[model samples]
Target: MSGSSKKPMRRAVVPVSKTLPTDPQDQHSSSEEVDPIFFTPSPSPPSNTPTPDNASALPCDHATGEPHRHPNPTRHPDFWFHDGSIILQVESKLFKIHQTILANHSEVFAGLFDVPPPLPTGTTEGDDMVLEGCRIVVLHGDTEKDFESLLRAVYNPSYFDDTLPPSADVETLLDFISGILHLSTKYLIRNLRQRCINLFTSKFPATFDEYTAKSTPQPSYSSTRSSSHKQERYRSDTLMRALHLAHSCNITTSLPYLYYCTARLSLHRLLKPRPTDVDWQTKSVVLAGRERLRYATLAISYSFLLVFERAPTCAEMRCGFASGPGREWRSIVLGGESGIGSAPTPPTAATSITNAGGVNGISASATAERKSKSSSNRAPNPLRLYTRWPELGVCDRCVEWNKGVHERGRREVWERLPGMFELEGWDELRKAQGS
Candidate 1:
């Protein structure tokens, strides 16, 4: 490298013999006031100062007999702009980024740059250290990877864009998304923080209608796999991680739906500890919430039993009878062995139905059979929208009435979901999100 083109590495120094001028007029003319780049010997130590022989052994420079200064950190290849005005040292990595760009994006950075940085570790007050022709600032309590992610988002316009298709791998996106969310929040980068919040809420929506839309499986066929299968795989793998992120980031709007998804997880999966496992308090919340969800799902799924007055425009009177649509619908939902479209048995314990009453004058023996069959089936989904009414031998008018009632009950469940997990209502959550 050519010496002439390189910026001088300078350290601030003061003359040993320099003394304050007695006269005010002589102060400005003092020859001791030299440029910061010029090297001057330090003043001699006080008589009481420890000598090398008597002093406790310490790491020191062999040549100077002074404590060793920190080694120069390795420079980041991608982020070191030639025209960068500031250097940020995170751990053992150095990032050269434009101060104006960082300041424009984050108020924290703006205020940080407004005040002078503290003197470097070995230097006294009023001593400044310059590296690569820029002020070197040491950033504490931040990882190199996270700072890189924050810098990428600041420099690259499309870094956090939502241009990726729905089929894009989510785990890969979460890698950068998590880093950006963490650092952005710490740096007070409002736009990047909000972008992260939007991404989370999109997956775990606050509203019932939005949650339903997201939950509705849209199957895309491929040579080897279906889109619905891919989505399910993603959810099963990432739901816990996402829940932990939401809880850590304080994304209140997404917590309700995230907790709901967690509540649906099998007990084995819930209890299995992982590196990112949530706290015991959240685990307790999930357990309590699961019980609440199971009870609500059963009640909502069987709400049709309460419809004593049949639709006047029934296609057939038999459709309302115990041996007809009424009994058939109960069997299908309760997963009776004799019913069509019964769910397959889950590996876990069966969901038990309690406090259920006889429906449409069904006999006691028939009810017992229904209960017996239900005890072997998986839990009912609280968010389930029954669209198989036509296959259940139900008339159009009766189907319409039951569907309306089920939809309303599902909405009610969604509204109460947050409270089950010790969170605020949707309206309050939404307000907090906006704030």
Candidate 2:
């Protein structure tokens, strides 16, 4: 959403891509992002540009089914096109396509319940990065606290007070967990988490991590059941989770507890009047600048566990280009690996590092973006994001990331971060943590 997310790149230590050597004159300018010789558009393109806002550009796919993938990977970026395409130019390649379309068609379910009014249908503001889903008003300050509040407001009793007829609550909950069907709760949580995670990861990876780690720890639940008839008691016990995730699914036993449990924890703090994380204002920027619907999986859970994996530049540590060679230093910036001879910056600081906005040290990102745009050189058509998804959830991105990190030796790399996975209160946990 903010910093262009990079793929785990691998190549020889030689200069892979060329950058227009910072002109001494241009270099005098106080910014890092290199300006394109021909500036066709900007993220903050003015309201007057011929930006399209066709609601149909939004994809309506579900998180459960085979996630909609661009039929033509040769067509666009991972996201579906909602309004227009982001045109990127790298050397000779160009690609363009709408990357944030939702094909789920299940948003109608939100209509059945009370959703905050649909975002302005035809607004000209979105080509930037993230989508301002049905809620278009620009919010101000304290994103985390405000975001938490939004979660709570959404759980308003009226929203969930509607009782379903006698149906299998367990099946509905399972579908919600596995994302096999459309329920407002399932859609909102998955979409919101996906959207928020993406935007924060790209723009503010550190802040995202802080938010994720600090959002709220899920409540402990005793899943042990003495008998199957404990349904009524069980639901009553977990009412907190349900209110937080009013997805209107048939509630049941095997919902993995984490499904509703995690969301409840997040929303409880969200609904509060004045959360500690709040400052003067409230704002939640959906996955970088992409809209609520235009999401791309960057890492899966297993991958996420390996926090030490670094992007290309940091991974190899400034492999100085000897010819026109610039000063380079070997660094390990992730998971507290600040000690690898040279200090490597984490992805979170990417914005600050590239204030003027350069690709965050990875060459493939620019290439991928440019390649995606070139494909759309012709007069374009409405685009879509995914084809079909599974009930399994799109945590695949994190899983993929773990695979990359494991290959790099996660524990050794993570040693850089100060207390990465170090368990706390060893003395106390040792007293109780059972070796």
Candidate 3:
């Protein structure tokens, strides 16, 4: 529900402040397991600020009484991201540091963005927008040496943010990732809602396929006519960057579904069939379908988590299709959305009234019943991937993360199995849930 504006992103103390404490480096740390944070669908930030471009007219939607569709500074330009196009802008030293990291981790970045996410193809790093922002206040000069020093400071892996005592320990990074994941999921949610609602009223695609029509990678994309290039893909390097940030904070989440949905909604443009399109019995069977086994071979620990927990919120959110919310609730353990809470709050049966002659007390799953009923009556297809991760479903590719990050060789103490993915306090989280 973030307000629609020129910008798709908004800066706030909300997530960053909330996330600073969860940076556990890995979930095995001895710190107490902090509870999980659920998702909150706040309306997009208000786009009340008038741009010089709109000086001629008032910013109002006469029909809906909403703001006009204008870009918000908070959001990166859609042109740089959507359609068969690419964007490579380097305005400041911050871009230099980002380029350094991007260069060092290009493979991973490629996997995340699903395209050659803009390389340092722009002018000097001094000209990058992100870097320029930093230079104005923090870095000052746009030299590599100065930027490197700043890079050392920003991702210091130490407890200090810009001289002031670090507002967070290293765990803040993980929260950053979680926040991004939430945003990515949020992006899917809001966009999909708009699409579904529009399609329902008028069966046409909601904005053109941003991916198919354009790309913003540094290098141009593969020739559009190549048959070999048909593996249409979607992976937001931006979203992945957020995922990495969240990992730095020791928060855990699912990339499989995020990637899958991004690939579908962002790339291929065809969503999987929804449960609402059919009936519940068939939906339940579809959920427990053979596809579940596709992820069984990733990593041992991940397999365990997958098997025990199953896909919870992500599955529910990824596709409107879900196998009864009740079953989903039992399997879910954490999230940042209303339906997806951090830890499962044990349901308590209560004494209450009922319809007609039945004066029975409220049943334990009364909440679930209400959810299903309400969702059933709704008139649109739901987009839940951007809302929940594992809760929705995991893809075949990322299933390997759970057993450990490095399956190929030896790992340092800090690089232990749990260390790589940034879920340092799993022991704490596990204990918190009395698992």
Model 3 weakest 10-residue run by lDDT: 132-141
RMSD of every prediction: 15.2, 28.8, 25.7
* Superior by TM-score: candidate 2 or candidate 3: 3
Instruction: Summarize candidate 3's per-residue lDDT along 103-176 as a digit string, tens digits.
Output: 23332222222322232321122211121222111111123333233333334534123443323322343332
User: What total of clashing residue pairs does each candidate reach?
Assistant: 0, 81, 86
Q: Which residue pairs in model 1 clash with each other?
A: none
Best by TM-score: 1
Report model 3's TM-score to 2 decimal places: 0.18
Predictions in order: lDDT: 0.59, 0.25, 0.27
Cα lDDT for residue 16, model 2? Answer: 9
lDDT for each residue of candidate 2 in 205-323, tens digit (9 for 90 to 100): 12223323423234445545432222122232233333222212222111112221222222334334343222112112111111111111112112222132333333333211111
Q: Can you give the lDDT of residue 42 in candidate 3?
A: 16
User: Across residues 327-402, which tens digit of lDDT does each residue of candidate 1 receive?
Assistant: 4445544554332222221211112223133443345446756554554334335776655565545567877877
lDDT of 2 at 100: 29
